[model samples]
Target: MRLLFLTNRANALRARISNTFTLPERFKGTVVEKWAKYWTGLVRDYKDVGVDVVKFGYNKPRKALVITGASLGLYACVKRNPDEEVFLQLLRQWNNKLILVSPTEQNVIAKEYVRDLELVLNRNTLRTLSLGFCTLLWVDLYSKDDCTYKAICEYTGVDYLKFYQYIIDIGFWNRYWRLDWKMRNFDINYL
Candidate 1:
């Protein structure tokens, strides 16, 4: 989920959500509602895939993703480099993930990430809403065979048998791979 720019989506992912998904529902017949209705299905797709969005989880795999995903940012921040785009992007991704998991997860977004988010939202309703929306979209489009997926698996030190079992239990992994997915049905032991 932390992989930057997960999909092009014709560069419309921002418009699809900030312009609609995260907004409170309007009248049923309103144009916004219609657009939101269409996005609801797609947005929901990413959330169910189960990848750790950015770096928000309290588990090993999640922590690994954060460490690996934000490595560049962390390095840049520590070095006090003049250009900290990677570090800034890391903050934005982490902060956005926090928004989606909030009310239980404490928000740790620094002033910088807030400014970055504000710049993206352009003074729209609730920056948190857009952050949450973007977070879901990032995870939604993740595929098991993608290079990012391999990196996460390598970092997580995934047990093929167990990971495959988890996918089967959940009605097939959110996204399949070229390798055979046949696995005996069994209870999952996920991290």
Candidate 2:
């Protein structure tokens, strides 16, 4: 499988539980220490926990894909890169799996993904509601209410946030990967 790290900052790979995952602080050597440790630890973590995302295709090989973005780019990563045809073509060239790791939301958008999502909703809601609606749709469409999600609800009692967190941290995904630290420094640009 191939690993894809898509985010605005490459530094995210080193984030820990409480780190902000932004530029190095540059004070008292905080950024340097964090960066060095983050990279080293991540290499170890990926080796241990099986990485956050893995790509699986026709069972040939494995590869890695990493993308960085500030605001709007994050959105494109998830909603389907605007030049999806090109991306799809590129993805097909590799025998390895396609793993994509990105923040849950994006900053700027072309509105096409949103429009398509709106068509799926049964009611007349603003585009902003699409995120929640999509989450619901995923839960329903995946029948997660009865499977893993149900288990999450039964145990955590925190609803989707916890469920989503669980999935992100589950160490099963290979393509779409997100460093746990990105949750903190997430900008409101695309999301």
Candidate 3:
């Protein structure tokens, strides 16, 4: 069972899998440590249940994409048959550097990630990404000013004052010690 991710060194977007998470900014003291322990424990819950969570990041195939002739041929096949497995199989042939999770877990994990990430990400995006993985996938709000941050919080469906600590903790999603989430934010960036 394996989960595959397309990534590049210069830009590790966290991609669609993490789109549902609300990652936190750098924080102080033991704040992050506590949150990390909580997040780790949460993930451990599923692993103990026989779920092997493996996320493999493979660089986008630069040479193949640049070669117009081959790309066209590949594109045609994908267009003709829109099966996801076909696309995944082609991906496997393109890169030898990979760590495959059990394919059996793909659908199940993708689904469970939505429910479980709600707890881990603990913050929702204004809506599902309109562009999905096509856009930059920063999980945390980058606004520095209060007003701007407030607007972002609005879209994320969190009350600024209420989630302030959870949003800016040294740990992104602190479950214990930090204040409890009043509204219970949820995200699916890792699915």
The TM-score leader among the candidates is 1
- Look at candidate 1 and give me any clashing residue pairs: 46-140
lDDT of 1 by residue, 112-154 (tens): 3345445533422111111211211111123344456544565
Off by over 4 Å in 3: 1-66, 73-116, 119-122, 126-138, 142-191
> What's the C-alpha lDDT at position 93 in model 2?
32
Structural similarity to truth (TM-score) of each candidate: 0.18, 0.17, 0.17
The global C-alpha lDDT for each of the candidates, from Candidate 1 onward, is 0.39, 0.34, 0.36
Ranked by lDDT, the better of candidates 1 and 3 is 1
- Decoy 3 TM-score against native: 0.17
Q: How would you encode candidate 2's per-residue C-alpha lDDT over 1-191 as one tens digit per residue?
A: 12434431333643553375445455446777777778868876775454333332223333332232334455544454223233223234321211122334322232333333334333322111123112111212222233556445555443555544323211111221222223223323454
* RMSD (Å) per prediction: 27.5, 22.5, 28.3
Candidate structures ordered by lDDT, highest first: 1, 3, 2
lDDT for position 135 in model 2: 19
List, residue by residue over 93-154, the lDDT tens digit for candidate 3: 32221123343433443334333434333444312111211211223443333356555564
